[model samples]
Target: MGTFEGLVAFSVTPTRPDESIDEDRLCAHIDTLIAAGVDGIAIFGSTGSIGSFSEAERRRVAEVTTKHVGRRVPVAIGTGAMTTAEAVRLSEHAEKVGADALLVVPITYWPLNEAELCAHYRAIASATQLPIFAYNSPVLTGVDMTPNIIVRLWQDGRVKYLKESARDLLRIPQVKEATEGRLRIFGGRDDSIVEALRLGADGWTSGAANIVPRACRRLFNFANDSQNEFAAHILQRRLAPLMSFLMDKGHVSVCHTALEILGRPIGTPRRPILPLAGEDRIHLEGILRSLEEEL
Candidate 1:
Protein backbone atom coordinates (compact mmCIF):
# COMPACT_ATOMS: atom_id res chain seq x y z
CA MET A 1 0.00 0.00 0.00
CA GLY A 2 1.72 3.14 -1.24
CA THR A 3 0.88 6.54 -2.61
CA PHE A 4 0.26 7.04 -6.36
CA GLU A 5 1.00 10.73 -6.50
CA GLY A 6 1.12 13.62 -9.03
CA LEU A 7 -1.46 14.71 -11.62
CA VAL A 8 -3.75 11.70 -11.94
CA ALA A 9 -6.41 11.85 -14.62
CA PHE A 10 -9.83 11.18 -13.16
CA SER A 11 -10.85 9.67 -16.50
CA VAL A 12 -14.12 10.22 -18.33
CA THR A 13 -15.89 7.11 -19.60
CA PRO A 14 -16.02 7.07 -23.38
CA THR A 15 -19.25 5.60 -24.72
CA ARG A 16 -21.00 4.90 -28.00
CA PRO A 17 -23.90 7.03 -29.17
CA ASP A 18 -26.25 4.44 -27.65
CA GLU A 19 -24.42 4.81 -24.32
CA SER A 20 -22.54 1.51 -24.30
CA ILE A 21 -18.91 1.77 -23.20
CA ASP A 22 -16.61 2.46 -26.13
CA GLU A 23 -13.68 0.24 -25.40
CA ASP A 24 -11.51 1.28 -28.33
CA ARG A 25 -11.98 4.96 -27.69
CA LEU A 26 -11.50 4.42 -23.98
CA CYS A 27 -8.12 2.81 -24.65
CA ALA A 28 -7.18 5.69 -26.89
CA HIS A 29 -8.18 8.05 -24.10
CA ILE A 30 -5.86 6.24 -21.71
CA ASP A 31 -3.10 6.46 -24.28
CA THR A 32 -3.70 10.17 -24.52
CA LEU A 33 -3.36 10.55 -20.76
CA ILE A 34 -0.17 8.53 -20.64
CA ALA A 35 1.24 10.34 -23.64
CA ALA A 36 0.33 13.67 -22.11
CA GLY A 37 2.64 12.76 -19.20
CA VAL A 38 0.24 12.44 -16.31
CA ASP A 39 1.72 10.45 -13.45
CA GLY A 40 -1.23 8.04 -13.12
CA ILE A 41 -4.81 7.33 -14.12
CA ALA A 42 -7.89 6.97 -11.90
CA ILE A 43 -10.54 5.07 -13.82
CA PHE A 44 -14.22 4.42 -13.14
CA GLY A 45 -14.19 7.49 -10.88
CA SER A 46 -16.97 10.08 -10.59
CA THR A 47 -15.66 11.89 -13.66
CA GLY A 48 -15.33 8.52 -15.34
CA SER A 49 -19.12 8.05 -14.97
CA ILE A 50 -18.84 5.17 -12.51
CA GLY A 51 -22.27 5.93 -11.08
CA SER A 52 -23.80 5.14 -14.46
CA PHE A 53 -21.95 1.84 -14.89
CA SER A 54 -22.86 -1.57 -13.57
CA GLU A 55 -20.39 -3.51 -11.43
CA ALA A 56 -19.50 -5.67 -14.42
CA GLU A 57 -18.86 -2.64 -16.61
CA ARG A 58 -16.74 -1.04 -13.95
CA ARG A 59 -14.53 -4.11 -13.63
CA ARG A 60 -14.20 -4.37 -17.39
CA VAL A 61 -13.12 -0.76 -17.64
CA ALA A 62 -10.50 -1.22 -14.93
CA GLU A 63 -9.19 -4.35 -16.59
CA VAL A 64 -8.91 -2.63 -19.94
CA THR A 65 -7.20 0.38 -18.44
CA THR A 66 -4.71 -1.72 -16.50
CA LYS A 67 -3.95 -3.78 -19.59
CA HIS A 68 -3.41 -0.70 -21.72
CA VAL A 69 -1.42 1.23 -19.15
CA GLY A 70 0.64 -1.80 -18.13
CA ARG A 71 3.68 -0.55 -16.20
CA ARG A 72 3.87 2.90 -17.75
CA VAL A 73 1.85 4.52 -14.98
CA PRO A 74 -0.16 3.37 -11.99
CA VAL A 75 -3.90 2.87 -12.53
CA ALA A 76 -6.20 3.54 -9.59
CA ILE A 77 -9.73 2.20 -9.85
CA GLY A 78 -12.74 3.63 -8.04
CA THR A 79 -14.21 0.85 -5.90
CA GLY A 80 -16.87 2.89 -4.19
CA ALA A 81 -20.42 1.58 -4.10
CA MET A 82 -23.46 2.36 -1.98
CA THR A 83 -23.06 -0.93 -0.10
CA THR A 84 -20.03 -2.27 1.72
CA ALA A 85 -20.47 -5.69 0.13
CA GLU A 86 -20.53 -4.18 -3.35
CA ALA A 87 -17.54 -1.95 -2.63
CA VAL A 88 -15.66 -4.93 -1.28
CA ARG A 89 -16.48 -6.94 -4.35
CA LEU A 90 -15.27 -4.16 -6.62
CA SER A 91 -12.13 -3.62 -4.58
CA GLU A 92 -11.30 -7.32 -4.69
CA HIS A 93 -11.85 -7.34 -8.44
CA ALA A 94 -9.56 -4.36 -8.89
CA GLU A 95 -6.87 -6.11 -6.87
CA LYS A 96 -7.24 -9.24 -8.95
CA VAL A 97 -6.97 -7.24 -12.16
CA GLY A 98 -3.79 -5.47 -11.00
CA ALA A 99 -4.89 -2.00 -9.93
CA ASP A 100 -2.12 -0.06 -8.19
CA ALA A 101 -4.54 1.68 -5.82
CA LEU A 102 -8.20 2.25 -5.02
CA LEU A 103 -10.05 5.55 -4.69
CA VAL A 104 -12.93 4.90 -2.28
CA VAL A 105 -15.73 7.44 -2.41
CA PRO A 106 -18.28 7.41 0.38
CA ILE A 107 -21.43 5.45 -0.41
CA THR A 108 -24.26 7.53 -1.76
CA TYR A 109 -28.05 7.24 -1.02
CA TRP A 110 -28.24 5.84 2.54
CA PRO A 111 -26.03 8.37 4.27
CA LEU A 112 -23.74 6.74 6.78
CA ASN A 113 -22.65 8.22 10.08
CA GLU A 114 -18.99 8.90 10.68
CA ALA A 115 -18.53 5.58 12.48
CA GLU A 116 -20.20 3.73 9.62
CA LEU A 117 -18.05 5.52 7.03
CA CYS A 118 -14.88 4.61 8.90
CA ALA A 119 -16.00 0.99 9.20
CA HIS A 120 -16.90 0.90 5.51
CA TYR A 121 -13.42 1.99 4.45
CA ARG A 122 -11.75 -0.24 7.04
CA ALA A 123 -13.58 -3.23 5.63
CA ILE A 124 -12.45 -2.48 2.07
CA ALA A 125 -8.87 -1.72 3.16
CA SER A 126 -8.73 -5.02 5.00
CA ALA A 127 -10.17 -6.79 1.97
CA THR A 128 -7.20 -5.85 -0.23
CA GLN A 129 -3.50 -5.21 0.13
CA LEU A 130 -3.76 -2.48 -2.51
CA PRO A 131 -3.46 1.12 -1.27
CA ILE A 132 -6.68 3.02 -0.68
CA PHE A 133 -7.34 6.73 -1.14
CA ALA A 134 -10.50 7.86 0.66
CA TYR A 135 -12.34 10.11 -1.79
CA ASN A 136 -14.38 12.88 -0.13
CA SER A 137 -16.80 14.40 -2.64
CA PRO A 138 -19.79 15.62 -0.64
CA VAL A 139 -21.56 17.24 -3.56
CA LEU A 140 -22.17 13.89 -5.22
CA THR A 141 -22.11 11.49 -2.29
CA GLY A 142 -24.01 13.65 0.24
CA VAL A 143 -21.72 12.30 2.95
CA ASP A 144 -18.70 14.19 4.20
CA MET A 145 -15.90 12.14 5.74
CA THR A 146 -14.71 14.57 8.36
CA PRO A 147 -11.04 14.92 9.19
CA ASN A 148 -11.53 13.17 12.52
CA ILE A 149 -12.97 10.14 10.73
CA ILE A 150 -10.09 10.23 8.25
CA VAL A 151 -7.59 10.41 11.10
CA ARG A 152 -9.13 7.34 12.68
CA LEU A 153 -8.94 5.44 9.39
CA TRP A 154 -5.34 6.55 8.80
CA GLN A 155 -4.31 5.32 12.25
CA ASP A 156 -5.03 1.76 11.11
CA GLY A 157 -2.49 2.36 8.31
CA ARG A 158 -5.01 1.23 5.70
CA VAL A 159 -6.07 4.56 4.25
CA LYS A 160 -3.02 6.01 2.52
CA TYR A 161 -4.26 8.93 0.41
CA LEU A 162 -7.18 11.36 0.14
CA LYS A 163 -8.91 12.69 -2.99
CA GLU A 164 -10.42 15.81 -1.45
CA SER A 165 -13.38 16.97 -3.59
CA ALA A 166 -15.40 18.56 -0.81
CA ARG A 167 -14.56 22.01 -2.29
CA ASP A 168 -14.28 23.32 1.25
CA LEU A 169 -10.71 24.56 1.06
CA LEU A 170 -10.52 24.65 4.85
CA ARG A 171 -10.86 20.87 5.01
CA ILE A 172 -7.43 20.50 3.40
CA PRO A 173 -5.71 22.09 6.39
CA GLN A 174 -8.02 20.27 8.78
CA VAL A 175 -7.12 16.92 7.22
CA LYS A 176 -3.45 17.84 7.15
CA GLU A 177 -3.51 18.88 10.80
CA ALA A 178 -5.68 15.95 11.87
CA THR A 179 -3.50 13.40 10.13
CA GLU A 180 -0.25 15.24 10.75
CA GLY A 181 0.62 14.97 7.02
CA ARG A 182 0.63 11.16 7.07
CA LEU A 183 -2.11 10.97 4.48
CA ARG A 184 -1.23 12.32 1.04
CA ILE A 185 -4.00 14.66 -0.15
CA PHE A 186 -4.86 14.95 -3.86
CA GLY A 187 -7.01 17.80 -5.11
CA GLY A 188 -10.17 16.35 -6.66
CA ARG A 189 -11.72 19.58 -7.88
CA ASP A 190 -10.07 20.93 -11.07
CA ASP A 191 -10.78 24.63 -10.59
CA SER A 192 -9.14 24.62 -7.17
CA ILE A 193 -6.01 22.61 -7.95
CA VAL A 194 -3.70 25.62 -7.62
CA GLU A 195 -5.46 26.74 -4.45
CA ALA A 196 -5.29 23.22 -3.03
CA LEU A 197 -1.62 23.00 -3.95
CA ARG A 198 -0.95 26.31 -2.22
CA LEU A 199 -2.74 24.94 0.84
CA GLY A 200 -0.45 21.83 0.81
CA ALA A 201 -2.27 19.20 -1.28
CA ASP A 202 0.09 16.56 -2.60
CA GLY A 203 -1.32 16.66 -6.15
CA TRP A 204 -4.55 16.54 -8.17
CA THR A 205 -7.11 14.07 -9.55
CA SER A 206 -8.47 16.27 -12.30
CA GLY A 207 -11.43 16.05 -14.70
CA ALA A 208 -9.94 18.73 -16.95
CA ALA A 209 -7.11 16.32 -17.56
CA ASN A 210 -9.55 14.35 -19.71
CA ILE A 211 -9.33 16.92 -22.50
CA VAL A 212 -6.11 18.78 -21.79
CA PRO A 213 -3.90 16.25 -20.05
CA ARG A 214 -0.71 18.06 -21.07
CA ALA A 215 -2.04 21.38 -19.86
CA CYS A 216 -3.09 19.82 -16.55
CA ARG A 217 0.33 18.22 -16.27
CA ARG A 218 1.97 21.58 -16.93
CA LEU A 219 -0.17 23.25 -14.27
CA PHE A 220 0.93 20.67 -11.72
CA ASN A 221 4.55 21.06 -12.78
CA PHE A 222 4.34 24.83 -12.72
CA ALA A 223 2.98 24.78 -9.18
CA ASN A 224 5.63 22.32 -8.01
CA ASP A 225 8.26 24.47 -9.73
CA SER A 226 6.84 27.53 -7.89
CA GLN A 227 5.76 29.20 -11.14
CA ASN A 228 2.46 30.39 -9.72
CA GLU A 229 1.93 33.18 -12.25
CA PHE A 230 2.31 30.86 -15.25
CA ALA A 231 0.09 28.21 -13.69
CA ALA A 232 -2.56 30.76 -12.84
CA HIS A 233 -2.49 32.15 -16.37
CA ILE A 234 -2.92 28.67 -17.85
CA LEU A 235 -5.81 27.94 -15.48
CA GLN A 236 -7.60 31.19 -16.16
CA ARG A 237 -7.22 31.07 -19.95
CA ARG A 238 -7.23 27.37 -20.79
CA LEU A 239 -8.91 25.47 -17.95
CA ALA A 240 -11.39 27.74 -16.18
CA PRO A 241 -14.34 27.88 -18.59
CA LEU A 242 -14.69 24.13 -19.08
CA MET A 243 -14.39 23.64 -15.34
CA SER A 244 -17.03 26.31 -14.91
CA PHE A 245 -19.42 24.37 -17.14
CA LEU A 246 -18.60 21.18 -15.30
CA MET A 247 -19.47 22.86 -12.00
CA ASP A 248 -22.61 24.60 -13.27
CA LYS A 249 -24.12 21.93 -15.51
CA GLY A 250 -22.76 18.43 -14.77
CA HIS A 251 -19.30 16.86 -14.85
CA VAL A 252 -19.96 13.88 -17.11
CA SER A 253 -21.97 15.90 -19.62
CA VAL A 254 -19.42 18.70 -19.86
CA CYS A 255 -16.42 16.38 -19.96
CA HIS A 256 -17.98 14.13 -22.57
CA THR A 257 -19.07 17.08 -24.67
CA ALA A 258 -15.62 18.63 -24.48
CA LEU A 259 -14.01 15.39 -25.64
CA GLU A 260 -16.44 15.10 -28.54
CA ILE A 261 -15.82 18.71 -29.47
CA LEU A 262 -12.10 18.06 -29.40
CA GLY A 263 -12.68 15.17 -31.87
CA ARG A 264 -12.33 12.44 -29.31
CA PRO A 265 -14.84 9.61 -29.72
CA ILE A 266 -16.26 9.76 -26.20
CA GLY A 267 -20.00 9.58 -26.77
CA THR A 268 -22.76 11.37 -24.86
CA PRO A 269 -23.71 10.72 -21.28
CA ARG A 270 -26.20 7.93 -20.58
CA ARG A 271 -29.74 9.06 -21.19
CA PRO A 272 -32.05 11.22 -18.99
CA ILE A 273 -28.69 13.00 -18.52
CA LEU A 274 -28.35 14.03 -22.11
CA PRO A 275 -25.53 16.05 -23.75
CA LEU A 276 -25.52 19.84 -23.78
CA ALA A 277 -28.25 21.34 -25.94
CA GLY A 278 -29.27 24.84 -27.20
CA GLU A 279 -27.57 27.60 -25.19
CA ASP A 280 -25.46 25.13 -23.24
CA ARG A 281 -23.95 23.86 -26.50
CA ILE A 282 -23.16 27.40 -27.64
CA HIS A 283 -21.51 28.18 -24.34
CA LEU A 284 -19.53 24.93 -24.43
CA GLU A 285 -18.41 25.56 -28.00
CA GLY A 286 -17.18 29.01 -27.07
CA ILE A 287 -15.35 27.58 -24.09
CA LEU A 288 -13.82 24.81 -26.19
CA ARG A 289 -12.78 27.36 -28.82
CA SER A 290 -11.14 29.49 -26.19
CA LEU A 291 -9.39 26.42 -24.83
CA GLU A 292 -8.28 25.44 -28.34
CA GLU A 293 -6.67 28.83 -28.88
CA GLU A 294 -4.54 28.21 -25.81
CA LEU A 295 -3.61 24.72 -26.99
Candidate 2:
Protein backbone atom coordinates (compact mmCIF):
# COMPACT_ATOMS: atom_id res chain seq x y z
CA MET A 1 0.00 0.00 0.00
CA GLY A 2 2.93 2.29 -0.57
CA THR A 3 1.83 5.72 -1.73
CA PHE A 4 -1.74 4.71 -0.97
CA GLU A 5 -3.83 7.68 -2.08
CA GLY A 6 -7.61 7.56 -1.98
CA LEU A 7 -10.59 8.33 0.24
CA VAL A 8 -9.98 8.84 3.96
CA ALA A 9 -13.52 8.94 5.34
CA PHE A 10 -13.96 11.56 8.02
CA SER A 11 -16.17 9.29 10.16
CA VAL A 12 -18.78 10.53 12.64
CA THR A 13 -18.44 9.87 16.37
CA PRO A 14 -21.58 8.22 17.63
CA THR A 15 -22.61 8.97 21.16
CA ARG A 16 -25.02 7.54 23.76
CA PRO A 17 -27.75 9.66 25.35
CA ASP A 18 -25.28 10.64 28.03
CA GLU A 19 -22.98 11.87 25.25
CA SER A 20 -20.36 9.22 25.91
CA ILE A 21 -18.97 7.53 22.80
CA ASP A 22 -20.74 4.36 21.78
CA GLU A 23 -17.52 2.45 21.16
CA ASP A 24 -19.27 -0.72 19.97
CA ARG A 25 -21.21 1.02 17.20
CA LEU A 26 -18.21 3.23 16.44
CA CYS A 27 -15.93 0.22 15.77
CA ALA A 28 -18.62 -1.38 13.65
CA HIS A 29 -18.73 1.73 11.47
CA ILE A 30 -14.96 1.61 11.07
CA ASP A 31 -15.23 -2.01 10.03
CA THR A 32 -17.82 -1.00 7.42
CA LEU A 33 -15.46 1.59 5.95
CA ILE A 34 -12.54 -0.87 5.83
CA ALA A 35 -14.81 -3.44 4.19
CA ALA A 36 -15.72 -0.81 1.58
CA GLY A 37 -12.00 -0.32 0.76
CA VAL A 38 -11.38 3.11 2.20
CA ASP A 39 -7.75 4.25 2.22
CA GLY A 40 -7.83 5.45 5.82
CA ILE A 41 -9.99 5.89 8.95
CA ALA A 42 -9.84 9.47 10.26
CA ILE A 43 -11.76 10.24 13.49
CA PHE A 44 -12.56 13.49 15.30
CA GLY A 45 -12.62 15.49 12.09
CA SER A 46 -15.31 18.14 11.68
CA THR A 47 -17.77 15.34 11.04
CA GLY A 48 -16.88 13.90 14.40
CA SER A 49 -18.00 17.07 16.22
CA ILE A 50 -14.40 17.88 17.10
CA GLY A 51 -15.18 20.78 19.40
CA SER A 52 -18.16 19.32 21.24
CA PHE A 53 -16.51 16.31 22.87
CA SER A 54 -14.37 16.34 25.96
CA GLU A 55 -10.68 15.39 25.71
CA ALA A 56 -11.43 12.18 27.60
CA GLU A 57 -14.04 11.07 25.09
CA ARG A 58 -11.63 11.76 22.25
CA ARG A 59 -8.99 9.59 23.94
CA ARG A 60 -11.49 6.73 24.22
CA VAL A 61 -12.32 7.06 20.51
CA ALA A 62 -8.65 7.12 19.55
CA GLU A 63 -7.80 4.18 21.80
CA VAL A 64 -10.77 2.02 20.85
CA THR A 65 -10.81 2.77 17.12
CA THR A 66 -7.07 2.31 16.64
CA LYS A 67 -7.01 -0.94 18.59
CA HIS A 68 -10.12 -2.21 16.80
CA VAL A 69 -8.88 -1.16 13.37
CA GLY A 70 -5.65 -3.03 14.16
CA ARG A 71 -3.81 -1.31 11.33
CA ARG A 72 -6.24 -2.61 8.72
CA VAL A 73 -6.33 0.92 7.33
CA PRO A 74 -4.38 3.87 8.65
CA VAL A 75 -5.94 5.64 11.66
CA ALA A 76 -5.53 9.41 12.04
CA ILE A 77 -6.61 11.35 15.10
CA GLY A 78 -7.71 14.94 14.56
CA THR A 79 -5.88 16.40 17.56
CA GLY A 80 -7.29 19.87 17.12
CA ALA A 81 -7.68 21.99 20.25
CA MET A 82 -8.33 25.63 21.01
CA THR A 83 -4.89 26.14 22.54
CA THR A 84 -1.36 24.92 21.83
CA ALA A 85 -1.05 23.20 25.19
CA GLU A 86 -4.27 21.25 24.72
CA ALA A 87 -3.41 20.40 21.11
CA VAL A 88 0.03 19.19 22.12
CA ARG A 89 -1.47 17.06 24.87
CA LEU A 90 -3.88 15.45 22.45
CA SER A 91 -1.08 14.92 19.92
CA GLU A 92 0.98 13.13 22.55
CA HIS A 93 -2.02 10.95 23.43
CA ALA A 94 -2.71 10.05 19.81
CA GLU A 95 0.91 9.01 19.21
CA LYS A 96 0.99 7.05 22.44
CA VAL A 97 -2.17 5.17 21.50
CA GLY A 98 -0.64 3.86 18.22
CA ALA A 99 -2.37 6.23 15.80
CA ASP A 100 -0.69 6.34 12.36
CA ALA A 101 -0.99 10.12 11.87
CA LEU A 102 -2.48 13.36 13.18
CA LEU A 103 -4.91 15.80 11.57
CA VAL A 104 -3.90 19.04 13.28
CA VAL A 105 -6.56 21.63 12.44
CA PRO A 106 -6.19 25.10 13.84
CA ILE A 107 -9.24 24.96 16.14
CA THR A 108 -9.13 28.64 16.96
CA TYR A 109 -11.84 30.97 18.23
CA TRP A 110 -9.94 33.99 16.91
CA PRO A 111 -7.89 34.21 13.73
CA LEU A 112 -4.20 33.62 14.23
CA ASN A 113 -1.47 35.71 12.63
CA GLU A 114 1.18 34.05 10.44
CA ALA A 115 3.80 34.15 13.16
CA GLU A 116 1.43 32.74 15.75
CA LEU A 117 0.20 30.13 13.31
CA CYS A 118 3.69 28.92 12.48
CA ALA A 119 4.61 28.86 16.14
CA HIS A 120 1.52 26.83 17.00
CA TYR A 121 2.31 24.26 14.32
CA ARG A 122 5.95 24.17 15.38
CA ALA A 123 4.98 23.40 18.95
CA ILE A 124 2.71 20.52 17.94
CA ALA A 125 5.27 19.10 15.48
CA SER A 126 7.97 19.14 18.11
CA ALA A 127 5.73 17.24 20.53
CA THR A 128 4.86 14.32 18.26
CA GLN A 129 6.62 11.95 15.86
CA LEU A 130 3.51 11.31 13.74
CA PRO A 131 3.02 12.92 10.32
CA ILE A 132 0.71 15.93 10.47
CA PHE A 133 -2.21 16.78 8.21
CA ALA A 134 -2.62 20.57 7.99
CA TYR A 135 -6.42 20.61 8.32
CA ASN A 136 -7.56 23.90 6.70
CA SER A 137 -11.31 24.48 7.00
CA PRO A 138 -11.42 28.25 7.29
CA VAL A 139 -15.19 28.36 7.35
CA LEU A 140 -15.38 26.44 10.63
CA THR A 141 -11.97 27.27 12.11
CA GLY A 142 -12.28 30.97 11.21
CA VAL A 143 -8.57 31.11 10.33
CA ASP A 144 -7.88 30.73 6.65
CA MET A 145 -4.24 29.79 6.26
CA THR A 146 -2.16 31.48 3.56
CA PRO A 147 0.11 29.37 1.36
CA ASN A 148 3.27 30.80 2.91
CA ILE A 149 2.18 29.67 6.39
CA ILE A 150 1.30 26.22 5.06
CA VAL A 151 4.57 26.02 3.13
CA ARG A 152 6.53 27.11 6.15
CA LEU A 153 4.96 24.30 8.20
CA TRP A 154 5.82 21.87 5.42
CA GLN A 155 9.37 23.20 5.28
CA ASP A 156 9.70 22.62 9.00
CA GLY A 157 8.40 19.05 8.45
CA ARG A 158 5.41 19.74 10.70
CA VAL A 159 2.95 19.09 7.89
CA LYS A 160 3.34 16.30 5.34
CA TYR A 161 -0.24 16.37 4.04
CA LEU A 162 -2.91 19.06 3.66
CA LYS A 163 -6.71 18.73 3.72
CA GLU A 164 -7.58 21.83 1.68
CA SER A 165 -11.24 22.40 2.64
CA ALA A 166 -11.38 25.84 1.08
CA ARG A 167 -14.18 25.63 -1.52
CA ASP A 168 -11.94 27.32 -4.09
CA LEU A 169 -10.18 24.65 -6.16
CA LEU A 170 -7.32 26.95 -7.23
CA ARG A 171 -5.57 26.33 -3.89
CA ILE A 172 -4.68 22.82 -5.09
CA PRO A 173 -2.02 23.92 -7.58
CA GLN A 174 -1.18 27.00 -5.53
CA VAL A 175 -0.07 24.83 -2.59
CA LYS A 176 1.31 22.14 -4.90
CA GLU A 177 3.63 24.72 -6.43
CA ALA A 178 4.36 26.37 -3.10
CA THR A 179 5.46 23.04 -1.64
CA GLU A 180 7.27 22.12 -4.88
CA GLY A 181 5.16 18.96 -5.16
CA ARG A 182 6.45 17.61 -1.85
CA LEU A 183 3.11 17.62 -0.04
CA ARG A 184 0.07 15.42 -0.50
CA ILE A 185 -3.20 17.38 -0.88
CA PHE A 186 -6.54 15.78 -0.02
CA GLY A 187 -9.70 17.53 -1.13
CA GLY A 188 -11.74 18.23 2.03
CA ARG A 189 -14.80 19.92 0.58
CA ASP A 190 -17.59 17.44 -0.28
CA ASP A 191 -18.91 19.08 -3.46
CA SER A 192 -15.43 19.67 -4.93
CA ILE A 193 -13.98 16.11 -4.98
CA VAL A 194 -14.19 15.40 -8.71
CA GLU A 195 -12.72 18.72 -9.78
CA ALA A 196 -10.24 18.60 -6.92
CA LEU A 197 -8.99 15.19 -8.03
CA ARG A 198 -8.91 16.39 -11.62
CA LEU A 199 -6.80 19.32 -10.47
CA GLY A 200 -4.25 16.90 -8.88
CA ALA A 201 -5.67 16.27 -5.40
CA ASP A 202 -3.88 13.24 -4.01
CA GLY A 203 -7.03 11.95 -2.27
CA TRP A 204 -10.30 12.84 -0.54
CA THR A 205 -11.24 13.13 3.16
CA SER A 206 -14.97 12.88 2.90
CA GLY A 207 -17.86 12.95 5.38
CA ALA A 208 -20.22 11.51 2.77
CA ALA A 209 -18.17 8.32 2.73
CA ASN A 210 -19.79 7.46 6.06
CA ILE A 211 -22.97 6.80 4.06
CA VAL A 212 -22.01 5.96 0.44
CA PRO A 213 -18.45 4.63 0.76
CA ARG A 214 -18.22 2.48 -2.35
CA ALA A 215 -19.57 5.37 -4.38
CA CYS A 216 -16.79 7.58 -3.01
CA ARG A 217 -14.25 4.81 -3.67
CA ARG A 218 -15.49 4.48 -7.24
CA LEU A 219 -15.02 8.20 -7.82
CA PHE A 220 -11.48 7.98 -6.50
CA ASN A 221 -10.71 4.91 -8.62
CA PHE A 222 -12.05 6.52 -11.76
CA ALA A 223 -10.09 9.70 -11.21
CA ASN A 224 -6.83 7.94 -10.27
CA ASP A 225 -6.88 5.63 -13.29
CA SER A 226 -7.38 8.61 -15.61
CA GLN A 227 -8.80 6.28 -18.35
CA ASN A 228 -8.45 9.07 -20.91
CA GLU A 229 -10.95 11.48 -19.32
CA PHE A 230 -13.41 8.97 -17.86
CA ALA A 231 -15.58 10.92 -15.44
CA ALA A 232 -17.06 10.48 -11.93
CA HIS A 233 -20.66 9.71 -12.82
CA ILE A 234 -21.82 8.61 -9.35
CA LEU A 235 -20.57 11.81 -7.75
CA GLN A 236 -21.62 14.30 -10.42
CA ARG A 237 -25.16 12.97 -10.55
CA ARG A 238 -26.13 10.97 -7.47
CA LEU A 239 -23.85 12.28 -4.72
CA ALA A 240 -23.36 15.96 -5.50
CA PRO A 241 -26.93 16.93 -4.70
CA LEU A 242 -26.73 15.68 -1.11
CA MET A 243 -23.24 17.07 -0.55
CA SER A 244 -24.16 20.47 -1.93
CA PHE A 245 -27.46 20.58 -0.04
CA LEU A 246 -25.61 19.92 3.22
CA MET A 247 -23.06 22.70 2.67
CA ASP A 248 -25.20 25.38 4.36
CA LYS A 249 -26.79 22.80 6.67
CA GLY A 250 -25.62 20.13 9.09
CA HIS A 251 -23.14 17.56 7.73
CA VAL A 252 -23.09 15.55 10.97
CA SER A 253 -26.87 15.66 11.21
CA VAL A 254 -27.25 14.48 7.62
CA CYS A 255 -24.73 11.68 8.18
CA HIS A 256 -26.45 10.51 11.36
CA THR A 257 -29.87 10.52 9.72
CA ALA A 258 -28.49 8.81 6.64
CA LEU A 259 -27.06 6.09 8.86
CA GLU A 260 -30.42 5.52 10.52
CA ILE A 261 -32.16 5.43 7.15
CA LEU A 262 -29.61 2.88 5.95
CA GLY A 263 -30.47 0.72 9.03
CA ARG A 264 -26.99 0.89 10.57
CA PRO A 265 -27.88 3.56 13.08
CA ILE A 266 -24.91 4.79 15.09
CA GLY A 267 -27.13 6.66 17.54
CA THR A 268 -27.77 10.41 17.28
CA PRO A 269 -25.33 13.29 16.94
CA ARG A 270 -24.34 14.86 20.28
CA ARG A 271 -26.57 17.35 22.04
CA PRO A 272 -27.43 20.73 20.46
CA ILE A 273 -27.01 19.28 16.90
CA LEU A 274 -30.45 17.74 16.55
CA PRO A 275 -31.30 14.75 14.39
CA LEU A 276 -32.50 15.24 10.79
CA ALA A 277 -36.27 14.73 10.45
CA GLY A 278 -39.45 15.37 8.38
CA GLU A 279 -38.85 16.48 4.77
CA ASP A 280 -35.08 16.60 5.32
CA ARG A 281 -35.05 13.01 6.51
CA ILE A 282 -37.26 11.98 3.60
CA HIS A 283 -34.95 13.71 1.14
CA LEU A 284 -31.87 12.01 2.66
CA GLU A 285 -33.57 8.62 2.47
CA GLY A 286 -34.29 9.21 -1.20
CA ILE A 287 -30.70 10.25 -1.80
CA LEU A 288 -29.36 7.24 0.10
CA ARG A 289 -31.65 4.89 -1.77
CA SER A 290 -30.61 6.23 -5.16
CA LEU A 291 -26.96 6.21 -4.14
CA GLU A 292 -27.29 2.69 -2.71
CA GLU A 293 -28.62 1.49 -6.04
CA GLU A 294 -25.47 2.76 -7.68
CA LEU A 295 -23.33 1.15 -4.98
Error of 2 at 211 (Å): 0.3
- lDDT tens string, model 1, 98-137? 8999889976788899888888988998899998988888
Question: Each prediction's Cα lDDT score?
Answer: 0.84, 0.85
Q: Looking at model 1, which ten-residue stretch has the lowest summed lDDT?
A: 227-236
User: Given candidate 1, what's the lDDT at residue 48?
Assistant: 84
What lDDT is obtained when candidate 2 is compared to the true structure? 0.85
Candidate 2 lDDT over residue span 106-177, tens digit each:
987787999999999899999988889889998888998877788889999758889999878998999998
How many clashes does the backbone of model 1 have?
Answer: 0
Task: Estimate the TM-score of every prediction.
Answer: 0.95, 0.95
